[model samples]
Target: MQVTESGADLLALLRELDDPQWLEWPTSYDRSAVAARFGELVARLEGDFGVPCVAEQDTQDSSEYGRATVPAEATVCGTRIVVCVSKFGSLALVCAENPGAYLGTQDAQEEGELDDADLASVERALVELGFTVVPEELVESDYDGPSRAHLYGQRPTWWDRFFGTF
Candidate 1:
């Protein structure tokens, strides 16, 4: 009916990290479908965790005109969890208590990025909700083929390697 200690633990971990970190749902599904699941999660956050959750359209050109967008983030126990859906429907995650952006690897480890416990709790909660957590970037084989840059023999920067990757 509502979230559990695991959810609160995740919120604590998010607060402790204080820097952006990444999480991935291995399975790619339509954003509309996932948004429903997100709604359930938001309900749990408010009903069980006592956190005020918010949902809003991302307002990014990359986002769809009027569908497939949700709050994409929330803060609980003083930490924040940000959820982002790709144009192609994959879910990418980042959490922080402070204001900034992290791309999973650009920042050094000394900055208090999320620890394993933090990742585990959030990942466990997601797994219970029917999503497989991928640790990092999806392999090239996960896609249909090499990207346009690779296909055309143009070497794109490592940062530009993946499609819909932030």
Candidate 2:
């Protein structure tokens, strides 16, 4: 089946597979079923939009105090579109014009970071999402980090507004 390229269409496809009534077993115990459903969606997207879609299972093991990470599927059109599934199953799509470019590899053992193919895929996905792809130099801008002191030349109070104090 062909899927529409719009975000709304993608969201609708996700909802259909994620719906509780379509499954033969409980979702908690049916991991393969979930993967299959996602794969089907990806296939449809590829067929309809000529975009590549790939899913990676999230790692479960982590340090005791480590932050929880979402499971992600990387879709490539003109830029990289990362669709991450939160613990609660809600989805968020983040587009990076240069995927894995600035960031180093997660594995310390790995020799290098993301290569050109990775960046190309990211660029493709971003374009599929209707973003205009431009050279980094054209859009580059600098912003300083938040200031430590309050705007009135004093430290912020507990009730002080965040951005206002900065």
Highest lDDT among the candidates is held by which one? Answer: 1
Models 1 onward score TM values of 0.43, 0.29
Q: Which run of 10 residues does model 1 get worst, by summed lDDT? A: 63-72
RMSD values, in order shown: 11.4, 14.8
Task: Compute the lDDT for candidate 2.
Answer: 0.31
> Against the correct fold, how does model 1 do in TM-score?
0.43
Summarize candidate 1's per-residue lDDT along 1-166 as a digit string, tens digits: 1223353353343233222222112234355675676665455445433446554433243321111111224322223544332323222333433213443411311355544444444545555665423223221123222343332234332112222333
Clashes of each: 0, 11
Residue 20 lDDT, candidate 1, scale 0-100: 21
| Residue-pair clash count for candidate 1 | 0
Alpha carbon RMSD to native, model 1: 11.4
The runs of at least 3 residues in candidate 2 whose Cα sits more than 4 Å from the true structure, single-residue gaps closed, are 1-29, 62-77, 90-94, 97-166
The 0-to-1 C-alpha lDDT of every candidate, in the order given, reads 0.35, 0.31
